[model samples]
Target: MTFTLGPKATSAGYKLAAFDQIGSTNAEAMVRARDGESGPTWFATTEQTAGRGRRQRAWVAPRGNLASSILEVMDVSPAVAATLGFAAGLSLESALQKLSIEANMRRAGTEPLQFALKWPNDVLAERQKLAGILLEAEAVAGNRLAVVVGIGTNVVAAPEGTPTPATSLAALGVQVGAEELFKALAEAWVEFRGIWDNGRGFGEIRKLWLERAFGVGERVAIQTGTTKVEGTFDTIDDTGCLIVRTADGRRMPITAGEVYFGTAASVGAA
Candidate 1:
């Protein structure tokens, strides 16, 4: 099936550039922005190679997976622009829920899949990593910040022996296609992006995100560079930092790190 923007996205003047195969949707979007394409445009593909995740880790989407990125050029600070990734996570989680419910209805006794947003940029299905999000931004010529939020999902295949155990929708019996998920994602993005409203409505977004957050109130460990911090997952701060309540009653706001939970938290696996 071909990828197309949902009606809401098209009506809102958002454009889509779908690809059967691409090196990286995020890279393509940034290149377009640098070439004077100021947009709320989506660059999507079913197969992605040479993709980079957070911390410059290689992220390759096999032929049946989905890799998509949305580019937005705005006059906002990098800090403010970073919060858009939360909205991106919410959008994908909403889309996955919609598709899972539909898939369950067609089956005899299947339960709906549970999806949650991992801190910073990931979507987890039943606590297993199902998708990853990467946010990249650069300053453009007109003093505008071109931000690309890339989301890659495992629709049919999941890599083995990852830091966090990964799972695909097919493995979970959701039975969704890349094209179908992309359409639902485009529609969900319109709603969340409207609520984000160029970062002015981050307060509402933060509240909504916490409601569907994963690992909150759980024992957590984060590794940043050579240092490791162990604490209870408290909440996310106003600026979207992971707020870990460490020992001694201190709420530490971690800006960036690799996260671990449960037994993995103590072992420092990632």
Candidate 2:
């Protein structure tokens, strides 16, 4: 029940710290960054006492769920560092696939699930949220950026009473543990981060992301700041900005926002 860093992480020069319980792995990682811990590091925990999501929304990851954060020092600007969200999402997807969770679902007589990646950093199975990603960044000396990518996934139990429908691998009859998934995730992160090539390979990343995109060409509402715009989910541009077309035929490139996939995706990171 302990979290350990495998060769995939250590060989890649990534350090890891684990806790039985913590206020927030992302917060701890950021604290390390501020304390002169220039790292490609991971902070993981079994339970989160004060977790949070984008826009400061409360994020609850109970024991048996996978809650982890990565602190990466990058040579790029803050804007470019945000692109790590895309890599994180893809890494989660790849990890799940490597674990063969879907095959287990099929053995349980459930039809094959159509997994999709939502805008920003959410993963969906049958259009329901299976995982979420949150990215935060800060600047250091020499214009270097320290970005933290927080990933939370339901494994043994899914939270009830949420904005949108939530699901876990166990709900779909896949037997998995947080520690096992974390191992796969560590390796997967190495692969995806290499593919990202420090923001230079975004062209390839964007293409792969589009291949697994969810709700493309579908009507949705994206809230940025005080403005809530309804539009069709277009595609992520080369720079990782989401492209949306409004009712007025105006195209908007949203740098970041809360996307509502109509009524179904009202998910509060639930």
Which one wins on lDDT? 1
Report the C-alpha lDDT of model 2 over 53-145, residue by residue, as the tens digit.
Answer: 877888888988989999998888777787878988899988887676546654775555567899888888777788889899998766788
lDDT values, one for every candidate: 0.94, 0.84
| Superposition error at 102 for model 1 (Å) | 0.4
User: What TM-score, over all chains together, does every model reach?
Assistant: 0.98, 0.91
Report backbone clashes per prediction.
0, 0
Q: What's the TM for model 1?
A: 0.98
Error of 1 at 234 (Å): 0.4
| Candidate 1 residue lDDT tens string, 151-262 | 9999999989888999999999988899999999999999999999999998999999999999889999999988898989999988999999989889999999999988
Candidate 2: stretches off by over 4 Å: 101-111, 262-270
| Residue 159 lDDT (model 1) | 89
